[model samples]
Target: MRLATVADMPRIGTLMRVSGAELFPRFYTERQAASAAIYLTEPDITLIKDGTYFVYEAGGEIVACGGWSKRNKLYTGSGSQQDDGRLLDPATEPARVRAMFVRADWTRRGLAKAILDACVKAAREEGFRSLSLMATLPGVPLYHAFGFQETRQTMVPLPDGVQLEGVEMTYELSQ
Candidate 1:
């Protein structure tokens, strides 16, 4: 895996859509999946620009993407007006693990774990004591296995009047 660039946005967006469509049905209702599909926005340029985003390529195809951030925005790329790009106080706030997705054909192969491990290591090196993420229903198991504790569950309202259930999870980095 390597850092993603703006040029990789199209492939990353495609991977997210394909992965979401295949995986969300395992936990979400059909209507919810369809409506919430709008939530699968393109890669956030800020992540790429910040050099925090990464893509895993195999057989010359981008198959997985994810990242961590020191920014206050917990999530973005859904075309929402919510992200403010404020810097996180790493002294107090946990680093944000954002936008994790794997290709439909690439699930359960340790790609997510690899990405998370990279993010955790990077965050720790950056002096963060903890990491946090808003995980979709399909991602809970992976995060849970990676030592993340769910702090809360909430619904994210999509633009199409549908809501996606998500969990807020955190992990404390071992010193």
Candidate 2:
């Protein structure tokens, strides 16, 4: 795994779409999945630019990507530019676990766990006391297994007037 660069956006985007296509249907209707898929943003450039995003490559192919952020935005990068890029106050706010995606063929291989471990370590090193993320249905099990407690269930509005179900989860970092 390594820090993602601007040039990696295309491949990252492909991975997200492919993963979503393969996994979303397990929990969502075909129509819902189609609408929700629109929200799977490529590389949130801000994360990459901040050196917080990472990509796991195998045999010269990027198989997984994820990252943590000190930024205030919970999520971004689906062709939206409304973020102000404010930094979080680690003393009070939990660091955000941003975009996480794995290729269809790479699921259940502990790739997400490896990425989450890195994100937790990095956030703790940055002085964060906790971590939070808006997890999709397919991701809830993984997050829960890693000690993230569900705080709420939310419906994230998509562009086509569709709302995708998501869970807000948090984890306290070990000091």
Please give the CA lDDT of all the candidate structures: 0.86, 0.85
Candidate 2: clashing pairs of residues: none
Per-residue C-alpha lDDT of model 1 across residues 35-99, encoded as one tens digit per residue: 65557545788889998899999998889999999887787533445445888877898999999
lDDT of 2 by residue, 1-175 (tens): 8889999999998888888888888989898788766676556888999888989999988899999999887864223445548898999999999888888788889988999999988898899999989888988998999899999999876677777888999999973
Q: Give stretches of model 1 more than 4 Å off.
A: 77-83
Q: State TM-scores per candidate.
A: 0.93, 0.93
* TM-score computed on alpha carbons, candidate 2: 0.93
Clashes of each: 0, 0
* Best-performing candidate as measured by lDDT: 1
Query: Any runs in candidate 2 off by more than 4 Å, and if so which?
Result: 77-84
